[model samples]
Target chain A: MKGSANRRVLPGYGLSLGYTIFYLCVIVLIPLAGIFIKTAGMGWADFWHTIWNARVIAAYKVSFLTALAAAGINAVFGLLVAWVLVRYKFPGKSFIDSLVDLPFALPTAVAGVSLTALYAQNGWIGSKLEPLGIKVAYTPLGITIALVFIGLPFVVRTVQPVLQDLEKDTEEAAVMLGAYRFRTFRKIVLPEIAPALLTGFALAFARGIGEYGSVVFISGNMPMKTEIAPLLIMTKLEQYEYAGATAIALVMLVISFIALLIINLLQARMNKRTISA
Target chain B: MAGAVTAHLSEEASVRPQHINESVLVRIVLITIALAFLTLVVIFPLLTVFIEGLKKGWDVYTASLRDADALSALKLTLIVSLIAVPLNTFFGIMAAWAITKFKFRGRNVLITLIDLPFAVSPVISGLIFVLMFGAQGFYGPWLDDHNIQIIFALPGIVLATVFVTFPFVARELIPLMESQGVQEEEAAVVLGAKGLKLFWLVTLPNIKWGLLYGIILCNARAMGEFGAVSVVSGHIRGETNTLPLHIEILYNEYQFSASFAVSSLLVLLAVLTLAVKKFVEWRGSKWQSK
Candidate 1:
């Protein structure tokens, strides 16, 4: 058996591998290369100034912080929701499960408007919230609300399968050994789900950073204030500030790329450790 | 005597720990909270917008579709997606077939690369094209030499779309193809079937649902796509504006009803896609269970 040839039935390599590289080049690589080449022409001093200007800097703070906040919120509650959907037996559980993806399929523009209408000062929930001294519609809070709306699916979807696949017997065994709920979760469950949670967080954060459609309708697009990075890039393009726009985009590209790479690596490592265990 | 009582209490506790047995009151409260979250987040905005549009009577809502700007914007969106999705589907199929049906080095890498668009925000995808084709971009001079109109036009819109949607079809098809091994193909081969006949007969039937699912998802995203399209499109009113762009224009011009009216239409389309997706997934699972 060991000596026998056991080649898989699918096609062999070489040609398809070459084609894959070529296809990726035409679609992804060349385009990124072109962006860099355009940016390369800009003097570093100007690039620094354009990207660091008050407006751009504000956009950065709004986009990065809101995205982080949104991802954090999603991580906590999204996990709870996933846990409920996976571990519970209840009526409408299936419906709640399907609803996780509703955010993914909903158009962001519609999502933005919908959120604004609900959270605007005069809007339904906003009218109620206003008397409590919490403003949402045109503030950074609005930005976070929009980010959270779009980012919800990432964490839920990422963590759900891991939760579902987690065997009940492990928890049972820990309980029999006299471990507390918190201890069992911390030692047995949290480690299993942590990497996936991190991946979801990174993805949600990346999406939050690049969100434009939802934020625009709600943010009021206030310059040096409520504007997000994506909106700023669009502004630069509209204003004929190509260098300005691409420069901002380059910074985003580097940060998001590095963040995504780390998350993906962590997910792989976690998966490997799980397999080995 | 106290030790005996304590031992009895410990024995009973060991038999069953006291738990928050989720009173009927608690369950209702929790359910209400969930419902409120859904209604506020997903349901209310959509219902309100559509209701407002129709509040002025269907006559006004009906006439919005006839607006020159709205019509042209729709026409552009339809045309661009019509071209972009099919082109992408072909690439998606080719990529999926080549990748999933093959065993090779870098296969995992290709799979990840294919999904790059999913994680890369559509806004970035749109900007990448602009960086490739904008007036001051790297390829702009070479492209401008040919007097080509790419960015800020229909071509630019299509290119941006093609990049953003590149993953959907391929992603949809992979799991379907993977779960379906080459058993049928091997059978076909043993029967001396080859080439197009083999693909059309043995392969197509097994994976048609996935292909359709991917195509529909791709189309829905393309049709409503705003962030990426906004970046690449100049939003030159009726010229480059797609349906989403048109809605923004209407909203900005203070034609609130018309914007929501158009958005109502996009929502309907999304719902249609969602239905089809459910149907396809349902169909696939049935086959699996069988």
Candidate 2:
């Protein structure tokens, strides 16, 4: 069985592999390379200036901070949601479970408009909050709301399978050993599902950072305040500053890739640990 | 006598400790919080879409859908998805087949590269294409010399869509096909089956559900794509606007009813996608268990 390492039994390997590489290059690789190439064409100083400009810096702060905030919120709430779905059998459970994927399915623009409508000053949720002098729409808080909505499914879906697979006996055994319920959950259950939760947090954070459509309408696009990095890139492009846009995009791309790589490594380690434990 | 009574009680409790789960009060609290969160984040916006669409009455809602620009936007969205979905499906199948069926180095790297689109911002997804094909881009001179346009046109829209949705199908199939392995296909080959015959008669049936699952997700994303398409579409009314872009345009113009009306169509599509996805998952699980 080990001797056939260099040979394959299947036909069309050449053709299929060729087509795959070619299509990937055309549709994905070549265009991504274009970003680096274009950014490289700009002088180092110019590139740095474009990316580190005060306005761009503000946008970065707003984007990263809100994304982090939103991902943090989703981690706690999404865990509770997944836990409830897995542990409890309640009426409308299936309906609630189905709705978790709504963000994935709904068009972001639709989400943006509807959320904005619902949270605007005179709108359903906003009017109630406005009387308390707490603005939601047209603020950073609004951007976080949109990101949380879009990022909810990532956390829930990632954690759901892991929760379902968690053995009940370990929990029961923990109780039998004189461990309290909270201790059992913290020591036994949390360790098993921690990796999935981290992965979901990373995904949601990555998505929230790059999110455009849903945040755009709600954020009000104020230059120094509510503007997101993606919207800034869009603004640069609309301004016909291609080099500037590419520079900002390249920065975001590199950051997201690094974040994903770290998350992947962490998840692999967690899996190995769980297997050994 | 008291010790004897205590021992008996302890034995009974040890024999059947109540299930290691939340108390009824705790369960009720958790469920309430989860449902409240879902209602706020998911259900309310959905309700708003329909409510606002009908705010001006049924006639206005119907009229908006029949608007000429709305009709054109719908057509453009359909056309883009129609083109983007098939191309991606073909690529997905080919890529998955190659990776799963062959033993090769750098395979992991290739898979990572395939997922590049997912990690990239949608705005950047559009920007990359513009950098490659925009007026000041590398191919700009060549395209202009040949009197062809891509940026700010239909082709650009389709390419951006393809980029955003590039990973959906391949990502779905790779894990599935990897699990299925090539033993069955090898057996088929030993029986003299080859090429399209092998794929159609053997592999297709085996992975049909997974493939369908991939296509459903890919189609949904293709139709719902907004940020990337918006960048390249030039916002040319009735020409470059897809349904999402159209919604943005109408919303910006304060045509609330019309925006929500067109949005209702997309909402319907989203619901349909969810329903089909549920059905597919159910069917896929049934097959897998078999």
Candidate 3:
């Protein structure tokens, strides 16, 4: 394969390719395979029973619903934030724009602690909210808040570039042709950026589902109430229920992959439609 | 005639199309809503970290930093990142080189496989390691006989960090190198540049900024990683605890000031990461325009 007569133009092709495959096998593939192999050892009835318990079912509901709500909230507000950053020039605009990535850079535990501090019953914002009878920390609402915090940047970052690429003249022309501001945005601008928005939503939802470090602090971690799927998996592992943990992880992984695949397909379709139109 | 013409011109001015911006009142409302959301979600939590860290006093904050456990946790984080970042950097460069420089079968499939870790939960990233090396794991008995520990130790932490951060560099480099094309490398090869010399002279300098950006993000995540590390670390005070884990210990014990102090160190790193990231983006855009 390395003979000079049949050699490719790029040098080190064999060496680099071999190292990549070998490294990937050790680093990624083999370990993931371990999950399947371990789960295979369990009886189908046991696996189903482990994953389908009432407490686990409630956890799945909380995880999916909170993640969905958070991602939906982000999809709407993230667009507004991205649009504001791109289109409007204001005092401290650059500062706020850079601040959007704070959640990405901050350690999740730190985020968890700080958010828990801020929204706890006697804490600053929490004290005020307590009077209004709106509890944030240690509730399902608190879990959603933490999810929203971590998921914000996904939507904003994904949509910002697309929004920037949208030609200003198109929006202007729509308005000039008697379209109202709302109509112009809905008909002209939204369709152009909808795919990016959907991609962002999927990314955020996937992230929220798997989120552990941040939510554990704010969620209060009561099994039937605030316990998330990842934390439940952690609990099972702590009890050395390896098979049970793997069963739950398998379900989460499959769901996330399927959701992401559907989103990718939708995005591809949207891109095709836009290009043709 | 002049008065009539002026009146018509005034009418045209009144009927002129609105700019992309909404009415001033509406724009104010939109901007305010957006800014308020950011302030609530991002800025407030950041401020809380510092304020709570200093809530006790300067001396208490200093005491937390000087605590033996905090110092050791910091050292372990540094060690873990030092190992993980360089190893991943090398892997990323190799993977990117293979994918970008060659036309191959199953290329897209390989790329997707490389990205599998990104889609995985951090908890699962750690769980897989436990499955691979835990007492009941595949090699667990063999390892137990040899007295070699991977789980509940530094090696486990490093492996988990590497798994979570596997794609950062390659993801950054693939698109960049793809856009850069292979003309330069092909030219170098034709001119008799071979092997390491070719990469050293031609490729490294070309992808330097992207590589640096990738390394910066990788290092930050490696140091700050919590969920995966937490699962495998066993939280042995100063033994396996990274900074984030240490913060969790302190916070759980209700040592609020101490936890915040340890957290302040990570906050500094986060700030530094963002600053360098911004610089890299600026430089990258400038280079592209050239």
Candidate 4:
């Protein structure tokens, strides 16, 4: 068995492996290293000065707060959408089901402009809300709406497969013990899908944090108000502040990496739990 | 007696137990909330793209699309997708083959690395290359010495698109190829099939649906890519702008009708992407059922 581990059962392994690694290095690894390599040349004071400024701090707050709100909204609605799709039958279900993926398919730039069109003061939805003294376009609220559009699919897609696999037998047994439908759902079903919901929430949050195309138009790019962390990087680059841009980008990259690592660990734990259960 | 009657009645009324059934009010409430939310978020903006695009009439819409800058942007987008998608596809196939077909050290690490681009912000995806190839970048001097331009040029756009889309095909194929196992390929090899022939006859047929699924997604992202391309593109009006960038320029210029018209085109692409995706998933499931 030990020797079998080294034995080749198929051909082209060397060719494919070499090509894959070579391509990965050229396309992804080397470019990513550029971020670190550029940032490494900066002194600690310069790096901190670039990243810890009022404008940069504001951008991070805007990025996190909007992303957090969007993900939160998505978690609730996404779970409902998944549950309704899986548990109930209705007209237009198929259409709605397909539409759930629109965010993934639609160009972020198109979504950004379309949403801006809809929520601007004289635009469709925004016209209806303006009398109430609310402004959506070119504000943080607009940014959240765009992020919501971007992140909506993440939560629903992640929760759907898990919700579908849930056993009806458990709910049936719970009901047979005289529990009501709501109680049965809360006590029996919610626990099962909790891990999936969390994963979805995290994914949506991470995506929203980095989202640029969809948020930029609606955000108005007001430096202290609606500016996002990614936009700041772009602003710096445009200003030829390569070190400053690299510093902000490096910090954002590290945070994104940490978030992704957490997600991987969470998914692994969830898979193990499912197998054991 | 009551329990038996309830059970009998429930059997006729529905397939599940009586107590598990939500009241009609609850079900209606839940479905209403879900549909309303979808309409507000997904449906309205979609409709708006078409409505505003044609707000100035068909001639205006047509003129805007036929605008030289618009056409060129469309051409550039197609060209970029044409190059980026296939290279990534080739890489995807090779990566999936290596990861799934053989037992190797660092396999998990390789897979995770493939996924790294997805986690990175699209802005950062562009910045990495700028840091590599921009005038102030590591390779800047060498490129300048050679009189070559990359960061604000076609090469940079292609590289950024490639980076952003690196994982799409591989991500789709790995789990699929893993599930299909290596037995079929091994059997084909034993029967004297080798190299390209074995892959064409055995592995390719088995993974065709998955591969198509991957390519469709990769192509969609490649063509629709905005952030990464924007960063590298100098936004030369008729020279370097892609469709999305063109739309941005038009919108920023207050050419609302024209901007929406151009967006209408990408929206059409998005719709096509979804339809093709649905068709492939249906076909893949049907093929699996066989």
Model 2: which docking level applies? medium
Which residue pairs does candidate 4 place in steric collision? Answer: none
| lDDT of candidate 2 over B145-169, digit per residue (tens) | 9999999999999999999999888
lDDT of 4 by residue, B1-290 (tens): 00000000011222344456677788789999999999999999999999999999999999999999999999999999999999999999999989988887899889889988878888999998889899988989999999999988999999999999998888888887887877777777778998999888898888887788678878888988899999999999988899999999999999999999999998888888777767767776677569
Alpha-carbon deviation at A192 in model 2, angstroms: 1.4
After TM-score superposition, what is the CA distance of residue A152 in candidate 3 from its true location, in Å? 1.0
What is the C-alpha local distance difference test score of each model?
Answer: 0.76, 0.87, 0.86, 0.87
Q: Stretches of candidate 1 above 4 Å error?
A: A1-20, A178-187, B1-32, B141-145
List model 2 lDDT by residue over A99-123, tens digit each: 8888988999999999999999989
**Tens digit of lDDT per residue, candidate 3, span A216-266?**
999999999999999999999999999999999999989878876765676
**Whole-model lDDT, model 3:** 0.86
Which of 2 and 4 is the better model by TM-score?
Answer: 4
Greater-lDDT candidate between 2 and 3: 2
Ranking by lDDT: 2, 4, 3, 1
What are the per-model DockQ values? 0.36, 0.54, 0.48, 0.54
Candidate 1: residue B192 lDDT (0-100): 88
Model 4: residues with Cα > 4 Å off, grouped in runs: A1-7, B1-18
TM-scores for candidates 1 onward, in order: 0.89, 0.95, 0.94, 0.95
Across B150-218, the per-residue lDDT of candidate 1 in tens digits comes to 989989999888877777887777766776766777667678886668778888898898789788888
CAPRI band for model 3: acceptable
